[model samples]
Target: MKTKELLFGACLCMFTACNMPEKGMDVDVYEALDYCDAQVQRTLTELKAAEGTIDYSMMPRNIMDSLNTWHCRKATKDEWCSGFWPGVLWYDYEYTGKATIKEEAEKFTEPLKFLSQIPAYDHDLGFLIFCSYGNGYRLTHNPEYKQVILDTADSLATLFRPRVGTILSWPRNIEMFGGHNTIMDNMINLEMLFWAAKNGGNPYLADIAVSHADKTMKYQFRPDYTSYHVAVYDTLTGDFIKGVTHQGYADNTMWARGQAWAIYGYTVVYRETLDPRYLDFVQKVTDVYLERLPEDYVPYWDFDDPNIPNVPRDASAASVTASALLELSTYLPGKKGEEYKNAAIKMLASLSSDKYQCGKSKPAFLLHSTGHLPNNSEIDAAIIYADYYYIEALVRLKNLIENKAVI
Candidate 1:
């Protein structure tokens, strides 16, 4: 570590003085796409070099050291973030139609096949399999990948306790959490189950997803729609226990990324079911988050943090919500649709500005992403999930502009 820490203010001052695109300006779809594709290529090439020194079978996680290189992780159950690096390659391949990127995506994705073969180790099977294989199968209908996704969905379904009405997120930490526990992040894993049920997997899979989402909507949120990071239940009786947080500033505060996942996941739930119930509910959740954000629309790590400007911002949360709102916009009509679209564009504008984008110093796309600030881990760094969603949002924005379909 350096003697003088690189705080958010100092970083902002440097990027501001360089004057890379004004923050309030609208994003040009092609221009932003070009920038993101280049960043993805840089990430791929740089990670290829680092693979020999780091673990070859691992995936990029975050950049922490002054060297600005990726801190990668193996594709183990605990390493829930391992799937995103391959997912980024797949997105680049979809944009460029380049065989080189597809080849690398396959190489990275093939190792994660073990996720389907194993028992339910954790709830991240969706993040592990869906983000990589789901995108891969969408771009290229590889039958092998389709089977892997179905199998993984079945594996994920094992953790569901019917009485609790949600999937247990961290089976390994059940005792630590005091019972059957579901986090806000578990809402995201529902997509794989929904997808599998529609495809060749079990029909009950969709039922499980709907149950999980309904339970989360009922118990995971307060009256104001702000959410808890973790909601625990009795392991034996399956009764409602208490709402808590594993990653937020506290049990009562809104963790920015937890709220982001709720927005994104419910948007998916609404899409799959076409349920007006979810559609109406998701906007309430999203509106509360938007109303609380800072001027640029990028959120601080925790909205309730006592230290405001001095605290780190979560570019990843902004990225996730940007992608979600773009899809949410399509379902609505009139002014509401346009408003959602414009909000997402403004977020993209701020992220595209040098205020957040890491031009050359970092191997990843953007900077100032806080991952587990309370643990003092990966604060204000280029976490790989941020890069993944940023690219996904850019592609979605471009698709909406071109009158094409969004993936």
Candidate 2:
């Protein structure tokens, strides 16, 4: 509840900053309306400048370039993260109708298309193929991209382990399912399954996703609305054993990123199933989330861990929540939806104006992102995924308010 108090105060301050004249109306909504439009323009400008060239998008020009070059050269399949950018670029292409973005994005996507051909796929497949090609097919009605999505879905469907009754979170032979079976991260994976089902007319794939969701809800969620970073369940009987904190302080302690993933994940689930339970879950988690947030609208990496005392906050979590709130807002029916929309808008406004980093040389993207505390990795730094999701959320909010597009 103290966190809620902080969130309300943060919202109140944002409201005042936007100079709203009315009571019971969100000043953040109007301000966000303006901000979303401006952000798209700015992002498009950058994308245009990139011009779909590998050398430009490569290192020496962008940190993403450096990161990708490192991944391409050094990291193995397991360590090669950040494969989500191509999909993000595709997302931008869909939203903006920019041919240049599409071209630049394919430079990233074409290789993944080959990877999808492999019978054995990995977790990043959903992030790469579904987010990019699947989205492209959905928007453009392109048959080739649609086939790519199906191929990827088929591979993912095969990855489902009957032992856990969930898709294998990692390709490792080790049996650890904690955090890998995380309900939060799997929601995005479910989106791919849903698309696969709709496109390929394979109801089984959709059913597999839904079943996994059902299992996750049963085992992972706690009574207090706080989520575990990882929960290992008996695949056979669906029993809970113990939770291992994959990225947070320890088991059962809330990781800010995981929490954000859950917030957005549950919101995505609600959109898919329209289960009242999902909505209730969202409200409960959002309530707990809003209650615990710091005044700046960013969250410390770990909610329960107080050892650091004065650690840098994960602004990436804020960006994720801002995006999730925007999606969750659209599902609202009438006045209540308006309130959620306003809250989301306000959160984004605070993020864009106060937290967002702007400059050419400033590598990664967005700003104030915290990756992990234990290893002292990219602590409180800009992250590309943060920028991608932030842009995704902002664009979604614009589409929602302007066209009233649901889902």
Candidate 3:
């Protein structure tokens, strides 16, 4: 683990210029942290300036994609992305210990109280509760936050069907046509269940999480370790219906974010359970991702899409994969760990560069994240989750350098 910090110090001595690192090399840790701090300060100033014009009733939201302008658009608490803005604030508070940021985090968190009471939370409870209240409890040790997370876990557990051995991702009535659908994205939500079960919610919740992962490992992936976006199941018999890609280029194509989710999800599963199979799976899938990624370490919206150089890049996928790789590197032994860490370092460097990092003119930090390309939605735009994961990766890197707990 000390290798990451040592590498940073070594790079400092090798380079004459402090801010500049050779292309594909890791930037100095101090410079990276300064970049994060500057981004946070700029975003906070913008948020405050927009206070009078933006609605606080549904406070935190994404800066909608625009041609030459950016503005926050309100989303309901149940919306999958609603928790990320507050999560960003919490990350800022965690990194800087700034009281104003913590106050703002609480302000945005207040609006999400209703999510815990919603009976049908689908598969996004982790993104909704864990990212916000979960991190809040971790930092503040607040009993109320703990209770909210537990209740949200309980709400999420209702979506699990024993026959399917997985949680339902979307409601059956939703336009997406699967009766008992389970998406690779749902795997990301299992962390909250694991946390709740370990923290006195219910031991069965942990069992549910493990079962879901096991089933996903069996069904959602291709022979090459790439993943399908969706796995439809027979609600009555728990049989597989079809493996499809809803947000990808085509059914056979590998959606960039789906692969990112698999990498992050399995790394998390290994963290929670110390399961060897999960680690093996992560290594295999991450190998494919690293091999397929372009020279800069960012990937196109879909890996299998025939359009190569002209395709839109998904910064969100790169950010998520980098964060996961940082944690995964810690768990690997010797040179393998260093390899993953270095790759992640390269990713952070590329992302921090002007090519992807949003300028002060934009409301968001990371830019060029394709939310759903096939749907003609949010393509090559700034996304909230991208910023959240980028900040999380930077803080996690800082924590590792300081010999602190990462998650």
Candidate 4:
């Protein structure tokens, strides 16, 4: 597929940039990657200078301060975002082939190995290990990274309940949620299971991944295919209880990131399994999400948010779904493939523009991501995963332009 990223995107036609392909994509993929290379190194240097000493526990999470510098919300990562920093480094290394970037990638990645030694501390092990070590191994063929990924996959599998047919998202929340809880976010983590299962980890890891996907597909989405952020199940009966949201606007609302996960997760499942079932299902999910987007193709943090134009926009959602669509496009034929690819190009264009690109204000790639509005935390911030997925999508786009697979 061609990148279709040349010529001009008129400033006057900014809102319609995605549709005006004759104007071309607003940003060039290589140019964006070059921007990422500078920003990643600068962010790391700034992060280290601010830190004074290297603390493996603390990773860059967001830009929430008055100075517009990246900061970690926690002293350590109990949150799911820690892996994204290293993951960004690894993707940068993959794109640039700079030995310095690769060396930096290894430095950031190796510290995450502790994630493998622990019991499943909820279902975030995949985000922690796979994004960091998984990418490290994929690029470097480091046997040690492979062992860690395998060990961490096994660690993550402990959360899978045979009765629930899905991984328990938060064990601590079981009593609060009143059942075996699985979140839509958990779908993205299954890639580690699928990868590990085929690559020297327990073979059942793939079964576990498939089982989780199948079960999530059954219970997590609404009849219209819009998804809830969380799905609670009866622990004893293995029956679905209700669909809800933790980070979304309301219980009945379609959380933007949650639905993005559905789009992305199912695409990955289809890639690994080549199942027409997931292919059809993901297209439905993608269509609904695409249909509801704002003029720029970026989504409000929640599709059902009553505020509409007043709400925070989530660049992270757009970037993640864009990356997924690039891969998903490769799997289809004819007009549908072109449609998805064009939609993704539009998203990258919007994200790459001055409206969202972080520029000089913050060291990260894009801005205006809502982490949890309800919790009043990191609202409209420059989040690490947003940068991770944004760069990942750029890398994928470059790969596609060169007639290569996104993987």
Model 2 earns a TM-score of: 0.79
lDDT of 1: 0.87
**Clash counts for all predictions:** 0, 4, 0, 0
Give the Cα-based TM-score of candidate 1 against the true structure.
0.92
Worst 10 residues of 3 by lDDT: 15-24
In candidate 4 the C-alpha lDDT for residue 96 amounts to 85
Q: In candidate 2, what are the lDDT values of residues 1-407, reduced to their tens digit?
A: 99999999898667554432235433244454344334434444444335542432331112331232111221123333434566566666666577876776666555556646777545556765766576666676778888888887887788677666677666562365632354356556777787778776477987887777776767666778787766666555646666666678877778888888888877877887788888977878887887887765667878887764577677678777878887786677676666566666565665666445443434334556677677767666656567667666666765664454634
Query: TM-score of predicted model 3?
Result: 0.91
For model 3, what is the C-alpha lDDT against the true structure? 0.83
| Comparison by lDDT, 2 against 3, better one | 3
Candidate 2 off by > 4 Å: 1-82, 173-183, 235-238, 307-309, 360-364
> At residue 401, what lDDT does model 1 achieve?
57
lDDT ranking of the models: 4, 1, 3, 2
Model 1 lDDT tens row, 262-295: 9999999999999999999999999999998999
Error of 2 at 17 (Å): 15
Per-prediction TM-score: 0.92, 0.79, 0.91, 0.93
